[model samples]
Target: MQLAAIREARAAKVAEARRILATAETEKRSLNPAEQSAFDKFKAEITSLEADEQRATFMEDCERRALGDPVGDRSFSAVQRQVNVVEVIRAQMEGRSLSGAAAEFAQETERRTGRKAQGVFVPLSAIESRAVNTTSTAPELVPTIHRADQYIEPFRNSLLARRLGVRVLSGLSGNLSIPKHGTGTTVGWVAENAALPTGDMSFDGVTLAPKHAGGITEQSRQLIMQSSPDIEQLVRDDLSFMLAQAIDSALIKGGGTNEPVGVLSTSGIQTASLATLSWQNVLAMLQKLDIVNASAANIVASTKAKAKLAGTLKAAGIAGYILEGGKVGDLPAYFSNQVAEKTGTPNTGRVIAGDWSQVMLGIWSEVDILVNPYAEGAYSKGNVLIRAMATVDAAVRHPEAFVVADDLAI
Candidate 1:
């Protein structure tokens, strides 16, 4: 059978197994002896079908290899070994306990890395085929449109804390306490019986708890079989981009219930009266920061506000402050979609300017991924679901070091 047909047959087998399991669980009780035995039998058949699909795919890859080479000189044994490596790598990803050939591969990997194979990413140096053609005819050199390899987030540059400095902490959850010097001690040339005043130092307590950020998606078995590597990469990038956007949103305007507290939303941060992006207001916003932080401070605004500011510079009466290389005066300006452009009824916008180094972001846990081959959502479609999760938080170390211009006219 063709590779696609084999994949479809395996998927049909999986669907059958799921149907049996579902029917047996309709009463929400433990399966009887006969039902248990039948379910086990179905599971064994599904396993056998999966193995058959793998073999069929390997054989097709070998055929492609033979057709691509002018001499048709590729050993079946070599192709089989490459296929085994790929399968072992996939088993490692699925968090299954490897045995047989897969177990030997894991052992060799551990010997080389000095750590368990499960914790490390074992790269597949060689695969059976690199170029895949769906047509039955002999292969030809054809240009292919590949997606952008390296993923870049739209809001990455505007994440102040992430750009300037971030405190990477380990653990599932924790609290941070930062010491504050409230008042200076009294300095005096004491007389015979004088007493000196005591210096006052206080600490601010911040609770850091990791809240789960995750998503799941399903794809048909045929789709997965068609372009496994490309589909895997696409799924991974999508998950990463989704998390990046989430973190950016929380850092800009989080409610503080479970996520990071945003600088604009946090109490007691300095605010400049910037009803509009006039040259005067812009200067005032820069001046609002302390001299020490002013040199290091940067501005983050929405794309809409940036356009408005560009127009403000061209206005006839206004003293245009030239924006050189995405900067206004000495401060570097950045734009993000996360910033609000139209907040209130009066059509207000927001502008954030600050020493971003004072902002701290805590990443609590590494991303965890799980694959469920028998998910109900994909059961009828004969597909599987991939889920990924992460945990993180953000905090401004010193609110005074940052400034926000809120309710500004757009």
Candidate 2:
């Protein structure tokens, strides 16, 4: 009834051909003209139907998910979906099969270019929440009309780059390379009959590949078992926060190994040095981006940088603050606690401003989650270990489009 029918028909034809050969062998005779004709006909059908077996099967299975999800209103069908994060944690804690939607999504994920889920597959959509509160201690309940129970999203960073119109490439497979034209061919006027100037253009590529950024937390098995929305919300938020932070952090601070290269470490970007937080220093960062014809769009800054800019005046006893109403003058800005204060000799925090559109965020997989009930010390402690991983990579379409100021001080 499904894609299986097509494969089965091909298999049946092959089986019939094998039987024809077997009968001839049993009778100690070679194939006659009629037998050969029948065998060749069966072979032709199979050859026409053949393809990469796994990919063919997956393509046949692809279809819209018209059915409602068992958990919340979100559905994970052929199209990658945003999901209710809490139900995902519950499924792993309960030690059972995933919800209908998640299970089907997971099967689809394994079938193709979707993320490779090693455990309970939570679509990254689960954590791409609207709530931006970074505080983990508070639990806020918001009403919902679609589900039997209202859903609560996890607290997460005010993720900046994506909101600022950064390019997003999702559901990708294998290594990807984007070619960039570094220089254009030159044409110049010359004397008649003289040799013309020859110029060759240089090109470069922005390479993106799968990099695993993982976060882990230990949970009380008893607490998770209670199924209290509040308890689950907190646990789910913690897990979601882990995934969210990793992705956000990788965009600012490149994950050193086995992770994407972030703005701070990516070579060829504009850099500015500031002994202290000042309007001049901030403007200088943008100026570098400007010289390269890069549009100054949004800013991603550390919470410390936000505080300093908000509190410090352009000049002592001056009338205005550098930052107001979550903006640096006309430019919209975002802050993250992970943009840490440096402990180096100068002791500064990181601030990045750029044409955020040049930042390429490639997602190879969604949030892949696994809960281990038998983790060391888990059984004795009555807890389970929860680990979530996101397969992603970051590339700068034009490194010159970004500028970093990591030496800003209070």
Candidate 3:
């Protein structure tokens, strides 16, 4: 009898442990040992299954009150079902004598699957960002300005029209050529037999006169004449507006300052000037004014300059340099090759190239300094318009004298 009681006690303990595991598995898919310990402690306090039901009901009532809901009784019923399933499984695991129904259910599950079911929980990192300062003064709200004249809304409408016209003209021109005939076809026979050939069969000058006369007609001349002023104005205005915006933004971000005072100079190669660049001078100028990130561009230039300037800048811990030209394509091959080599490696820095307008736009948009070897004739009035479009809001810090901004707003 004493031995039987000991076996019953051990079975009870095992059953209780299984019940605790089941509750934890239902609440969370998995628990670490610490979390499992908390569940076991709670389970140990319950004197009977009725006590467990009462505790669960009370907890359900509390949750319903906290959530301000009317379904506390239904929630408790669900919790009871979960508790019952866990307790029954625990009892079977502990070697207790199960009821016929419980024994049959356990046997059926064991027959279907030899392994016990388990739950798993995956861990994740918490994402975070800088908190907003509630105590700071409110930012001043700027009113949105709407243009009064729809027709004169910069290049808005004209740009689309110009693009459409170009597309149509290109499509028409594409269809103007004659289609190729298949093999073994002579030019004279193909011209005569072709379905859509311009019939000019006779080789005599008198017979060809009519076809030549048609080419010289006013209608033919009108086709070329029709495409002049509107197209020209459209391109001019679009370029003008874009450049203006780039320069304006650059000036604003670069602290609304005038161009730096110095003779706008250029090196046939940026590497050639690397030795002469004074870091102290550049840093002093940067400190005196608000210049955005300059190190990247400087570093790129240094790299392109190779040992000549890169080593100096790297030793001084200077970070960036700028290249001047209209397009990335326009940069000298030697400089570009050097830049490509250093990209993504440890001694990397930003390299930029553009005409004044493009570089300036890049500066304003990227909040970086515009770098380029200065050139005067590189931006004539017409080309300046194009450059301005390219750089719109960036500061045009080129040394050359050009109208950087439109005094009269378009």
Q: Candidate 1, after superposition: displacement of residue 378 in Å?
A: 1.0
Global lDDT of model 2: 0.69
Estimate candidate 3's alpha-carbon lDDT, on a 0 to 1 scale: 0.27
**Per-prediction TM-score:** 0.58, 0.68, 0.14
Which candidate has the highest TM-score of all? 2
- Write the candidate numbers in order of decreasing lDDT: 2, 1, 3
Roughly what TM-score does model 2 have, to 2 decimal places?
A: 0.68
Model 2 spans > 4 angstroms off: 1-86, 89-95, 114-116, 128-163, 276-281, 311-318
- For each candidate, what is the lDDT? 0.56, 0.69, 0.27
Score candidate 1 by lDDT: 0.56
Kindly list the per-residue Cα lDDT of model 1 for residues 195-297, writing each as its tens digit. 8756565445655656656666564455344435654454444444546556667777776567778677777678887675567777766666644333235
Distance (Å) between predicted and true CA of 311, model 1?
1.6
Flag regions of model 1 displaced more than 4 Å: 1-161, 170-182, 187-199, 222-232, 291-295, 314-319
Q: Pick the lDDT winner.
A: 2
If the candidates were sorted by their TM-score against the true structure, best first, what order would they fall in? 2, 1, 3
Per-residue lDDT, model 3, residue 47, is: 43
Please tell me which model should have the higher TM-score, number 1 or number 2: 2
